[model samples]
Target: MREIDVFIDTEEIADFFYQELIKRGFIPAEDEIRELADITFEYLLKKDIIAEEWDE
Candidate 1:
C-alpha cells in the first residue's frame, strides 16, 4: 500500500482528480502526481466523469 499526497495551487482541479482517484481506487506515487495532474482533467472529461456539454 502506498500513501500519496499531492499539493497544488489549483484547488478545484486537485479536488477533481482526488475524487476521480477515489472512484478508480488509485493511489499514485509522488513522482506520478505531476503527470497525473497534467492529464487527469482531460482524461476524466473524455471518460465522462461529469455529464456536461463539452463532454457530450
Candidate 2:
C-alpha cells in the first residue's frame, strides 16, 4: 500500500485498462459485475477508505 494519492495517473491508467478490457470482449456482463462486486469489495478491504474484513 502506497500512501501516495496518484489519483490523476490512477484514473488515466484505469480508463486505459477499462477500454482494453472492453476491446478484448472481456467486459463483464451486468449480472456478472454484480456478482463480482463482492470480490471487488474484498479487494477494497485491503485499501484505505474501504478497510473491511477481507477474510471470508
Error of 2 at 8 (Å): 6.5
**Per-residue lDDT tens digits of candidate 2, residues 1-56?**
56543222334445555666689889755555544555555566556445433336
RMSD (CA, Å), each prediction? 13.0, 7.9
Evaluate model 2: give its lDDT: 0.52
Per-candidate total of colliding backbone pairs = 0, 0
Instruction: Give, for candidate 2, the lowest lDDT window spanning 10 residues.
Output: 4-13
Which segments of model 2 are wrong by more than 4 Å? 1-8, 28-56
Which residue pairs clash in candidate 2? Answer: none
Model 2 residue 34 lDDT score: 46
> Which residue runs of candidate 1 sit more than 4 Å off their true CA positions?
1-9, 29-56
> How much lDDT does candidate 1 score?
0.58
